[model samples]
Target: MIVPTRSSFSALSCLMGRLFSVYAGYEQQDAHEFLLNFMDKLHEDLNRAPHRKGPPVPLPALVDEAASLNVRINHFWCQHVDRHLSVISDLFEGLLVSSLTCLVCRKSSSSFEVFSCLSLPIPANKGSVCYLQDCLKLFLETESMSGEAAWHCPSCRQKRKAEKRMIIARLPKILVIQFNRFRCETAWQSKKLQTYVQFPISGFDINCFVDREQVETQPRPAYRLYAFLNHYGTLATGHYIAYCRAGHGGQWYMYDDASVTEVTLSESDKRNAYILFYTSVDMRHQFSSHP
Candidate 1:
């Protein structure tokens, strides 16, 4: 049996349990098997002894490594082991369509990529109260890549200035938003952005960030906040804890290292939020109906 040694692993396990509970299509046995496989792989990869002592490793890197392993393990099980369990990918992965339009020729090109998380950049402006909507706006904002960084337009047949933007092509059952608070300009220089970003605890409408055509065709999807990862302290040294709500009872709990405590909704929604997790409201109802 795999044991949780770190807060990140425990938090992830809790989030996965929430996901499995909300999606009745996934079998408990299969989910348990997947978790075991993920933990085993993560332990093996992270426990490799080095030849000599080196600089201290960052916690974020280890968390990211564990997450990547989870994704890979989920993909392998869904694709190679059992195709019916592909709901794992459907719950988290979504398609993002990026468009690059040439300013001179007025021609546009588009590409689609699947994304598991949205990493939003924090503005450099200091002492400004920020909101999640502002970060979403910044993410979708069109930017003109001019000068040497200009894109090669096929129609213009030259390096020309282009405007690039990204929009959601497909929506997933679970949406994960990552606020990039860590900044590192050089190897030795690193800092954390302590900007206050306000996010809705429930009824977060994502239609505005999606493609216009998608909004017109499908019903507007609203999400309810269920879990979030919080980071405390500076960039070089910090701790990661998670706040999650029970799928059935709607009670919030905080997971810190080996301790778990019940917390109020107000307590769960804090400025230290680093990774936010939301689930589609409609799917929640659909799965709750199942025994």
Candidate 2:
């Protein structure tokens, strides 16, 4: 029955203030939102290059179409590191490569963006069941961008139909995945999908979801689930609970407000999962010291 000391409790309260200046006064908070805000603030506060003098240095131009994908990825990543260097960036940040290919010219342009979490969309299913890989695949699926969503191809010199696809270009030490369960069905209506998204507790490999051409060559990394946050009830009224691994290769425990209990998650419990936190199996030693 380990409990946080008074100092630790106060530190958590201060961290919450970093996330939100005005507390909701015991009103239920979205766990995902809180996590994101806290992470962002933590990065900002702990940034090594917090204040830069003079105007920001311009990024290197990516005009060379013949350059290899890894070259471009590294160029962008180096530029990013020059401005934002923090443990948060080192551990949690991952790069995504988004390619837009014009259907007419067949010419493609790619852009890289850094992300702290991967928000995956659940594909429409006849039954209320799907796997985590299905959601990841759905997220990485290419979509035809036409009509209003069309892209103006530089090669075609016109608004042409394009195929847009996104793939992971860099892997992070800690991967945070969020399920897009809340849906806006109508202008005034929204609903949460109770789809059972079965995820791997161990040996979770995301290599297939990554752009092998862009990423550096290395042995495949396996991730083990460390923690997951679940939301119960509707969008308006929901309670958040966390299931955290006790330690490296340890039992899972459910953490509710003011109560903690050992838990072997049932299928029903997994259905409520909102955010999943996974750590690289090779990095498991790092988390063994912390509960």
Candidate 3:
């Protein structure tokens, strides 16, 4: 009664095949041909039988909605100084005033400024993929992609849970990460944050999210009172790596726990730099008594 066809048979692979085909033919401009190809893809998707028990990720949307912001810069530190002359301070002012002085370090000696100007042997050309990669890495660190563990606020202090809300104070190259640690505000009540926190700069929670379900309900007795970083989809901009070498040349990320390496910045450290934030997601302050 019915005709068996390839589109109906092995539908998923066929759908995948259409995707590949579309990708390959994307640059080809033929309205009639494109319409036919598009129709084929639509048919494949509609007919593709999916088993929900399989992997969690839905098939890739395959549609390019917008461009990604995975951008970076070579000798970014040098560039940072160039951009934030104020952060570089006297040297930047000197460079602006005196043509001979180095703009970055404000050194009078020709050798120091001259040597400093040479960034990365051959500085990678601007707007290269390397820069984009750096941007992506920074985004990952700051947003939901950040993998650092959580710390708990005092009121809902669990084993290692922190509040969802975050506020920061930034000055030049100095940054204070303010986390809401749970401690007693007064004798009677447990408060969110009485003191402004100055957590060390460290790797961020990439997957920031607020548990809509949990926020409304009581956190599970076992795992109560916690906030999410970012999860799944979140809005973000700019990026950077905030880490230092712990041992060897191997760098380490800063975290709520013992991972962060505390360093006091000096005028020298501030030589050629400005603040760079990797990502900032709209965080959840509080929901309700429940999860």
Candidate 4:
């Protein structure tokens, strides 16, 4: 090592003094968190630099995240990073985020992957990519919010000749749910016609029954649609079904309707099962065989 002269040593000592002085002025707990975070980011950024900007990940292997995923540090770390410093804050935060990454089995540029939070909200900070775990935790209701399952290989998803497994996810904290049923009334359409349905959703063993009326006839068939209500209802894995014939009004069906006189889930969030809009009479008429 090269020994420094008195003036050089003095300057170095002054620099360290300034650093400790500033650090000491802040809350000790904050300082500790800051330091621990800094060291972790420092290690990650150093390690991640070598793995970036390579060829695309493989194909068949790439489809599985367990095999193709690898975390990359999106930013770097610095000892001088302070919350007040905008540039340093941005850089260090990115490094910290990417460090806790979940790699795919075989990830490529085209993988149907996005981020979600594990513990906090997506983007609780300045720069946030959703963490995968958080994405999985939330039940997919709307088509837009659904992830990879929302869409599948068009060719592969329709294979009914062999074994098939439908995946349903139960999300956390269902706050409110609603179910509505309407009886169609029309003279011309009223006849000896009944619509009976038995379809599976995320929860509840349900059978929707619609029967025509011989009473005051209207322009349409009299049909009774029983949209059962189920809250936190457990259901077998299957397809989601829905249908509308001209003037029919309906809402979602929840469990806890039959035995309970008044089933009200005022302070509950609904957990949705994963299934696209599916409708077919054959699937509904098989309730007897299904146990």
Where does the lowest 10-residue lDDT sum fall in candidate 2?
49-58
- The best-first sequence of candidates by TM-score reads 2, 1, 4, 3
lDDT (0 to 1) per candidate: 0.67, 0.83, 0.26, 0.25
Model 4 poorest ten-residue lDDT run: 206-215
Q: Can you tell me which runs of candidate 3 are displaced by over 4 Å?
A: 1-129, 132-140, 143-148, 160-291
TM-scores for all predictions: 0.68, 0.89, 0.14, 0.16
Per-residue lDDT over 47-96 for candidate 2, one digit per residue giving the tens place of the 0 to 100 score: 78533333446776878775877888888877788778777887899889
Predictions ranked by lDDT, top down?
2, 1, 3, 4
Candidate 1, pairs of clashing residues: none
Best by lDDT: 2
Candidate 3 lDDT tens digits, 78-166:
33343232212311111101012222332221111211110111112322123222322332232111125443223333323222221
**Regarding lDDT, does 3 or 4 come out ahead?**
3
lDDT (tens digit, per residue) of candidate 4 on 152-269: 3333442122211111211111111111111234743322111112223233211111011211111222213223222121222222222212112333333221221223322121
Q: Tell me model 1's lDDT, rounded to 2 decimals.
A: 0.67
Q: How would you encode candidate 1's per-residue C-alpha lDDT over 157-188 as one tens digit per residue?
A: 99999999886766777788888887887999
The weakest ten consecutive residues by lDDT in model 3 span 114-123
Off by over 4 Å in 4: 1-24, 27-36, 41-119, 122-136, 139-291
Angstrom error at residue 251, model 3: 35
